[model samples]
Target: MNKAQRLLHILMTMQAHRKFNLKELTEEFGVSKRTILRDLQELSELGVPLYSELGVHGGYQLLRDRMLPPIHFSDKEAVALFLVAESLKGYPMLPFEAEVESALKKFYHYSPPSTKEKIEKLRSHVLFHVQERGLDTPYLTSLLEASLEGRIVTITYEAEKGTSERDIQPIGVYTASGLWYCPAYCFRSREPRLFRADRITALKIVEDQSRRIDPPGYDLRDWFTGRPSGETAELVIHLTRAGAVRAKSDPLLAEGLTVHADGRGCVRRAAAISDLSCLADTLLGYGAKAEVEAPALLREMLLQRVNEIRELYAGAGG
Candidate 1:
């Protein structure tokens, strides 16, 4: 069973028993004491009315009197909720993550057993993961709140060149590839710029704005459809079987991928990228499994990076 199922089982067990301790629950679940403790903690985070007492004579007891009514979900709604949660699988350090997590757990708990099985089986068959980049944005919730309220925000940000501070009018936030971005109207620059959410080192909510200058309409759909903001190149790449498999879910990498009948495929989507460095990083992640097949400059750059990485790791364990 998945963690959701295990959590639901724990919840049911606690509801049935008056004083089940960690050792007893651990033995029942065949999991470590630490795992049982984590489940209890998560349950508490989800607002479960659980109280624990000390000493061997004491154990955990659920507050049945304060229990909330069971939530009902239709079969389709349950599946949609599960899929939406799954889509955020690798989003790093999301805003109000605990609440979001608690909601998902409850969604699972309330789902019908048949619906849960379908979710689990589909989940097990597919894999999606993204390595978190170097930075994390913990103030994301604040920024999102400020954006909706039409308030100005002061932020200290770090980029490739250096660090700087700015007060900006938050337009919106979106995720691309595997990173979070805030496209806002910079008060200093007087133009819309995309800020990496994780690169925001500091954030402060300013006073509500009376005279809000509407930010130029920005749409993420355009970018997803291969329209980038700045200079771009039309390049091509041949995908070994592995690269094709990985690209299926990638926002940019999946664009324009053509798979021939012979189980061979290629992606002609270099124009879909706005940031060259991001494209390079995506290609590097695929290693030799992705071959740059066009645009001599990009091909050369990828080759050089591959050679450098190979040399750096070549002598390991020698």
Candidate 2:
């Protein structure tokens, strides 16, 4: 076999046998010991995490997080992966931002010239538009790690009420509307609460195991698809054609929307009381296109906001 083919085979072989000696590779590929040694050096240079041992029981070992063997992808699969990575560019921050960019660069560098041209053309035509957000979520990676490890963390959060510190065990971190959020079990409140990632001014893992709380197995999918748990009231809103079109664009509101053949629709779902103010703000933007039909509390909140706006404008005019 050619040197190039032999080198690839050796990498695959080493991956299969995590620990091997130069003699074994020499015998397996029918190459000289010196040549096998040179191949191992080349692999090391290519960032394969390999190390040698001096003791009798030791030979060569791949590190626990060794680089994976090369993977072949079809043209379509390559393009799809590129598109997925490209979509992340819309977000202001990501837990693995550097890794994504590195992988994308490698994909572009290794692809055939014709495939590169096709990818460049597709980049211009395909776009995943997300609203740009100014806030930076520097703690996204830390929050994600805490969730995976089931560790508690103390965060200095800047909420609407004011800045405060609290300990929480995070369920997970997710992004929507170009902003990052963490759903966690707040020790201070003794309940699950969502916090804006960017608002976390400071964070550090709570190393004291005694302070850790057993977090619920809360599925983020439920947060997206189903109504929140605990006390909630039914919300119903009549929508005009334009309102229906606008509501369909919202990930949360669209879940409960139903459209009829006449181009009209309604939003009917159970909404937590704690969420009414935020819901009022969102629906208020719909203006005359949407009319609240149920839930007196939400209507009241909307009215209060309207009055506040009118009062401010009146004072300005005066």
Candidate 3:
């Protein structure tokens, strides 16, 4: 790990154990005792009350009486922190907005001079977009914490056109298309399912006894590593020449597409597709050049949506 990551790890370790010996720190980080001692000293200088204890049971710890200034971040850490701050801004439901802002200020101030200069360049070069809104960052964060601790959580979720409260044992958090979702075993539904963080309105951690069964055996790491099973759809799209040209330029649209000979442009068989709304919007952007071929239901949905759009715009005079 880099220096910033190591420092963060050290802080987390100290938070968990409240104290650790030199040997333990050196062994855990695979660094020499000398190096670990230097890092600890640096931490102390940064206003981390890292006090060293004498004798066998005593070791390094945050001094009880003093408050520590924020830890310094390497360039990479600063960039990552800034990106996360930007992401959190998109989620209005997060309760810790002030905390995130505070941490970001400290990170920016403590970043190396070289990294500080790169921040603007990085921001201009990198970008991310999220379509859904009102995501409950606080709730999502709580669920992740609960999953790590194997605890239960109660959440108020807004379903399509309605709302209800539920208690669930969250297995893990998953991200797809710039949105975070949680997979859990809902106590009310008594089944394993997924929930979009954007739809969650409130959350509370329940006692551990609320767990219904030993948490599901599904491998959470495997589930969130990529597209989880059951989240994707298979479709066949027929694109005209213009549509194919435009789609070929889009990495997102072209993924998992197999082209077949059609009269005008080509037929594409697609799999593992999510966000049908985005798909329709993209196709509509190509005007009449793109049309769904198979999955008649999806085709009709797109066609109806297009027709509605035409009607809505028909009154505009030349």
lDDT digits (tens) for residues 1-318 of candidate 2: 988779889889878888998888888999999999999998786567898998878799888765787798888888888888778888878997877776687668768777888899989999888788789888999998898888999999997669999999888888877878888878887767778899999999887968776536655665666557556799999999999998898755787899989999999998877667778878889899999987998899889989999999999999
Q: Could you tell which candidate, 2 or 3, scores higher by lDDT?
A: 2
Instruction: Give the runs in model 1 whose Cα sits over 4 Å from its true position.
Output: 1-92, 98-135, 146-154, 166-171, 175-179, 183-194, 205-219, 269-274, 293-297, 314-318
Report lDDT per candidate: 0.75, 0.84, 0.68
Which pairs of residues collide in candidate 2? none
Pick the TM-score winner: 2
Looking at candidate 2, the ten consecutive residues that score lowest on lDDT are: 214-223
What TM-score does prediction 3 earn?
0.51
Assess candidate 1 and give its lDDT: 0.75
Q: Total clashing residue pairs per candidate?
A: 0, 0, 0
Query: Which residue pairs in model 3 clash with each other?
Result: none
**Residue 35 of model 2, lDDT score:** 96
What is the C-alpha lDDT profile of model 3 across 104-147, one tens digit per residue?
66667667778877887777777666556444456766777777
- Greater-TM-score candidate between 1 and 2: 2
Candidates, ranked, lDDT: 2, 1, 3
Query: Considering summed lDDT, which 10 consecutive residues are worst modelled in model 1?
Result: 218-227
